[model samples]
Every structure is written in C-alpha cells, then in structure tokens.
Target: MSTDTNTVTALPMRPVVADVLREAADADPRLVVLGADGQALAAGVRERYPERYIDVGIAEANLVGVASGLARAGRRVVVCAMAPFLVRRAAEQIRNDVANPGLDVTFVGVGGGLSYGTLGPTHHCPEDLGFFSALPHTRVYCPADVVDAAWAVRQALAVPGPAYVRLGARADRVVHAPDERFDAGTGLLMRPPGRALAVAAGAGVGIALDAADRLAGPGHTLGVLALTAVTPFPQERVRELAAGVDAVVVVEEHLASSGLGAATALALAGQWHGAFAAHSVHTGYPPIGDREELLAHYRITAGDVAASVLDAVRGPGAGARR
Candidate 1:
C-alpha cells in the first residue's frame, strides 16, 4: 500500500505470500502448501491448516514429486522453496511430472536472481525464466513487489496448469499502486509513454523506474515497462510500445542471453527498427557480495542502466548525448 517509489518496505512480499496462500486455502479446502526447507516462510499456513501443509526438508526434488503426485490426485498444490534449488534441483521432476501432465501446481521460488547475495551462484537463480518458460503447459511470473507478488500467487493458484513465481528475497519496492490492475501477459507501464522504453522485470523494475526518472527532461522522456509475467511473453504489448519508441533498453537481474531482455529482443525480431540494448547480468558465477554489491559488480545499477538507455536512445544519427 506504499506510494513512495524511492524506498522499499522490508519483508513485505514474503508475508504476503503466506497470507495469499492462507486465503486460497480458506477458499478451497483442496489447496495444499508444500515447502522445501521453506517452512518458516509458510509458517502461517502451517499454523492455520496443519492438515494441508507439508515440509519436505531440503529435498527439492522430492518436493516437486510430491506436489505433482498430489496435483494428479485432484489436489491444488503449491511448492514454496528457494529459487535455485526449486528450479534447478528438481528441474527434471518438474518437466516430467508437473508440466507433462499439466497439473495444478504452483511453484513459489524465493530469492530469485542475485537476491541470495553472498550465498554464491549455487543459490542464485538467474536462469529460472529460461528454464521455466521453455517448459510446455507452464507459465512464469517475475513480480516486482508485494502487489505483483500477491497477484502472481493468486493467478498461479487460479490457473489449472503448472506455474512458477520467481520472487525477490525481501524486496518490497512500491512500483504499483495498492489497487493496481494486472492482466497476465501484459507489461505495466510505470511511467508515461516516451520516445524510449526501459523494459524490466522482478527487482529490475524499480531500477528501470529510477533510471526513467533520472532521464526525464525537456526532450529525454523514457517510459518504464514492468514485465511481471515472463512466459506468454507480452508480444503484442511489447510490439505496440516498441512501435512508438525510438529506442528500447531491457534492464533485468538475469543473464542477458536468457532473461526478459532476451525475450524482448526476440519479440521485436524482424520488426521495430529502433536501437535496442539489454542491460543485464552478462557473466556467470559472479563474485561473492551482498545484493547491492553484486548488482554494482554486474553494472546492473540504476545509474548503469540509465547510461545504457541513454546510449541506445542516442545511437548513431540519433543526436549527440544530451
């Protein structure tokens, strides 16, 4: 419910996940919440519905297998686990069990991208979007804040197929209003339309918004697009926005070749002649550091992203840098 775009609330989205799961469980008795060493995050659900909650320890593979089995048995299942382990550890189980049969399973992966910070690359999950989006009968969501996270949880539950919700560790940036209307497969424009657009997802949305704000001036208007939904890539909306923009920059906390930036580039392929730049993590297994340190290391900060956008907007014959 915060309107301040400059600051983020601590532990906002994490509690919202538990609340959403509790509410869904209240509405449907068939709803079951499973945790892969994530019981603490879903403690509320365990307390409220003991019969419907299961903690599978650190066995992420077994977590997916159990969830898939329950889903096949006509149960609404949600798997809450660390992002990297959930997406990478149980990838095969997810593909063969949940995605193949198209079961009702929602995987809530916390600490996506470099959210794990100093935890090392084994805990970082920058490849989840590519892995999940490539799966059939699967939908991927990368929410920006608590509002988007809540919506993703609800949407993943409402849908009757396998879904993945990659969330930040504790980022609660207020990118959207409390009552923001969200339509799946459609990116939300956080700023007014401009000559250039900064498309981003997850934690990068706030950075993109900041970059857009920093570039706002007499003739340097930049729009910020928040792509909460990854799979079912909002091709039409992206194309529509790209048609009016002179340049496009994709800022994300993922690998440049396999994240939102890659998706955006592909969506605009064979069309949209504007200059484009994808400002994302370009290296693998970055050095150990906190979230901010790591983002700075990868040059994914707001300042770096703003510079990239300006460079793209001011490409050859696009006028000198302001």
Candidate 2:
C-alpha cells in the first residue's frame, strides 16, 4: 500500500459531505450549489460560499433543471439535496436536460441508502446508483472514505457532463489517508492481501470491514475493497484485482441486482473471463431499521464479511479449499 499519508491537522474529521463540498468550493470558482436546506453539518457550505449556495426551497425538479441551465450558461454547477426527493422527483429533469445533453453538471446526493435510518424506506437511496448508471453521460462515485469523498467532489467538479456522488448522513469513518490518489473508474484495496475481497462502496465499506474483522480466523482473511467510483465501472482495474483473488464477496447498501456486485460480476465474466465459487453472495435491502441495526440484521458487518470468507474457505458451505 502507498505509505504517503497526505494528512493535515484538521479536526477528527466527521466524514461530512459538506466538508468535502466546502473543500471543493474553496478551490473551484465555477461551482454553484443548489439545495433545499439540510443537516447542520452541511450548513458550512452555506456560510462559506454564500453567493454560490442556493436554497431551492424543497423544489426537486427545479433543483435539477436550474442546474442544467446553469451548466449551459458556463457554470460548473452541482444540484445538492436529500437523496430520495432529489433523485426521484428530479429524475425527469436530469434525464431530459443534464444527462441527455451531457451537461457539465453534478449531483451531490446526501444521506444515500439507509443512512437516513429512522426516516424509513421512503428515504432509502438503494436505487440511486442503478438510476445514475443507466443515464447517458452520467458517472457516479460513492466515496468509501473521507479522503475519497473530498477528492471525489473535486474531481466531479472538474469533469464535464452529469456526475453523481453519494454522501452518507453521519460523521462516518475515514477509510484512507489524505494523499491516497483516486480517479473515475478506480477502486482502493482497503485491507492487506491473500484474502477474499469484499468489493463494496459507500457505507458498505464500513460494513464489509466489520465483517472481515469478525470473520477472520482458521484459514480465512476477508479483505475490504473500496470502490468509490461507480459509473463507467472501473473495468480494467477491477479485472486486474479479480484475476488474482480467490473469491470476491460484493456488498452494497443498494439493491442486489444493479449494485456493485452485479457490476463486478459482469466485468469478471465479460472482461476477465473468471468465475467465483457459488459461495459468493450479494446484499440487497435488508430488514429495515437504523443503519447499524440494518447492517447487523442483514449480516453485513465486518464480522459477517469475515464469516462469509471463512465459510467460503473451510465451512461446509465453503466446499473444498485444499
């Protein structure tokens, strides 16, 4: 692993999406932010970039359309809002204007997946990745760590056309150090090697890490593989990793079919010409509850990931492992 940790004396760093946005806005001038109010952690963008920050008053469609117009008018804009409303309500606008025209606009969606917890499934963002991946000229990146989050925000701002990025609801963990390099269609190996890789994204990385830690022992090492960039699916890099690992356990906080697992499987079969053991598994929407509760109930924690690895290697379900 790259040992150069490009870190600063910042706070414990709550992995706030706003922190990433604030960091991006500090460097870029063409950024215009649109939102319908948000958590206090996100208010810093409003405070710091007052002229560029806009409160669109809960109108989701207008949020996207206005951003599309701004991009056409030579502004590198971002439509920021809660995931459910921003995506579902404005999907038409997104499809018709931003994505169709390949406009240089981006959507920074906060509270992706069940990060909204008690808000219930209505606010769950399980399909956002699938939705964004299907749209023309749309590139999605769900950062698996704080460093990647901040870096991804900046990269999306620089790239032309519609890009979507996921930001979790809480002050999450920092999956990597500051200096770790990331780009579109790339992934990070968040753990040491010689183990099955849990290819995952967003808060799913945390879950996989937990599963890995808990499941390790007796001829198994569950490694955490973090894929921050989703759309345009890092085919070559992912194939390279998939070619070497004994097994790939894909976990995501999104739907089972179109989430990272599906993406990785397609790449392996179509590009790498490889197949994992039948023990490979994918996670869809779990029994509903808070994020922690949901992860535990669904066996998505690090312990769970590790357990899956163990099962694949030695458990009866794992079959013959020499």
Candidate 3:
C-alpha cells in the first residue's frame, strides 16, 4: 500500500486540471474559471489566463452563484473548490441555479473522499456522488488519473448542462495509457479478462487495479472496470461488463450506500444473478488518519478488495484472506 514515487508516477490532478482548463480557455474566450479561495490549486490556469480566472474568496455559495450567472450569460464556467464545501455547503446554489436551469457549468470538486484525510470528516466528501447524481440535468465524473482528469474537463465543457468532476487533492497513480481514448459514459477495463470483475471509480480505480495484480499471484485473475463518469450511470455498459463474470465486486472510496457500489447494484438488479459484493466505507464518519491509513481502516485497500473478490469468487464462508 506504499505509494512509492519510483514504482508509479504520482501526477497531481489539480495542476493537470488547471493546465486543461487553461487550454480550454485559449480555445474559447467565454470560458471562465471560478474558485473559492482555491487559487493555489488553479494557479496554472490563473497565470496562463489571467483575464478568465476569478477568485470568489471563501464563500462557496457565492462561488456557485457566480459560475451559474456566468454560464447563463453564455460563458462556460468551471467552479473549483474543496469537495465538501462545493458539494455540501453550496448545494442549494448547485441545485437551484445550475441544475435547475440546466446551465453549462462544471463544478470541479478537489480533495474528494479522504484526500483531505487528516483534516477530519468535515473536509472529507464521501457523499458528493449521491447528492450531485440525484440532481436533475447534472453529469457526475470521478476520473482516476491525470489523463481522465483532463478528459473530464473537456467533456464537461462540451456538455450543455451542469457537470461535477470529483478529483483527489494529491498526485494520483497513473491508471490509464497516454493513447487511451476516454469515452465519457463508458467504463474502462484496466486489467485482463477474468472470471470476476472489480468495478471501481475515482481513486478506487487504482486500488482495484492493484488488487487485480495481487490476485494474479494466487492464480486468480480479476477484470477491473474503472468508471470515469458516474452519473448518466451507463446502465447498458455496466450490464454488459457483468454479463458472464462469475462474481462482481464494486469498490469505491465513498460510502457504499450511495456511491459506485450502490449505482452498480441498481444497474444490475434483476439482470445478473451472479455473486455480488461491495467494498467501500460504511455509514458514519471514518477515524482521523492519513489517506492510506484511512483506506486500511475502512477496509478499502487493495488487500481488502482482493480478499473480498476472493470470497465472492470462492463462495461465502470460504474465509479468503490477504
């Protein structure tokens, strides 16, 4: 579980996002970047496109409102802020202003899940997908790496309605190839074909990939389905992925109640009768710790995922262990 810099490149999602936003701004003069004291994360965009960047101080509500207004005025606006405040604190504006009118605004939520781990439950955003996905006319994205992060920015800008792109705070382990084509509503298969499939999104995608690798040594191969776009749930694609798998395990950093786990369950309900399991944080606030510690504490790590997949594939009471 060590995030060794040598083994994998840890590309921070914020800077990659800023770079992509700056490129988008260059193409369209009407595209603007708004932040709620998130200037540090969007510094690259601010420096490259000074005229298009706006910092709305600490008011998360005002941040979303300004973005909505700008979008209503025919400008493509990208609102950047910590996930908790952007999705929870300014939820009223998100629901009323952006989603209600179906404005072309992209809400970039940084530090998603436990990215702000040591900052406690107040800063952690584990329920963003549930809230945003439930809103009408809104698209939700949880990109796993830099490539998908950049692609999400482009996809959000192209969409004519509200969109939410959830990103981790620190650098993420690369999970996609440079030449990999990003299909908005389709899940990417990260591992080789196997009897079981691990469906994951956001940071959990990387974790799921690692679990697949670990399972290989035991002669157990698991397919990994990494989802970039969560809302606009991609029901047909998910059903296809689960078609012939002996077991399906849904892994995510958020709570199982309303995250990828829940979405997958809803999608395959009455369709697939194979072994189904969900690995994610259960209800309630997690104990304070760093990202790795928190993941282990909640049993959402690669080892935990591997164990869960093994149990599902081997059947209940098999007592699979990492």
Candidate 3 least-lDDT 10 residues: 313-322
Candidate number with the higher TM-score (1 or 2): 1
Per-residue CA lDDT of model 2 for 23-80, tens digit only, reads 6677777777787765343466678879888777888998888888888999888777
Which of the predicted structures, 1 or 3, would earn the higher TM-score when compared with the native?
1
Question: Candidate 2: deviation at residue 93, Å?
Answer: 1.0
Name the TM-score of candidate 2: 0.83
Ranking by lDDT: 1, 3, 2
If scored against the real structure, what TM-score would every candidate get?
Answer: 0.94, 0.83, 0.93
lDDT for each residue of candidate 3 in 198-261, tens digit (9 for 90 to 100): 8889888888888887787544588888889888888888889778676788888888888888
Give lDDT for model 1. Answer: 0.84
User: Model 1 over residues 86-133: C-alpha lDDT tens digits?
Assistant: 888899999999998899999888988889888888888888888888
Give me the runs in candidate 3 sitting further than 4 Å from their true place.
1-6, 217-219, 316-322
Candidate 1 stretches greater than 4 Å from native: 1-10, 317-322
For each of the candidates, the C-alpha root-mean-square deviation to the true structure, in angstroms, is 2.5, 4.8, 3.3
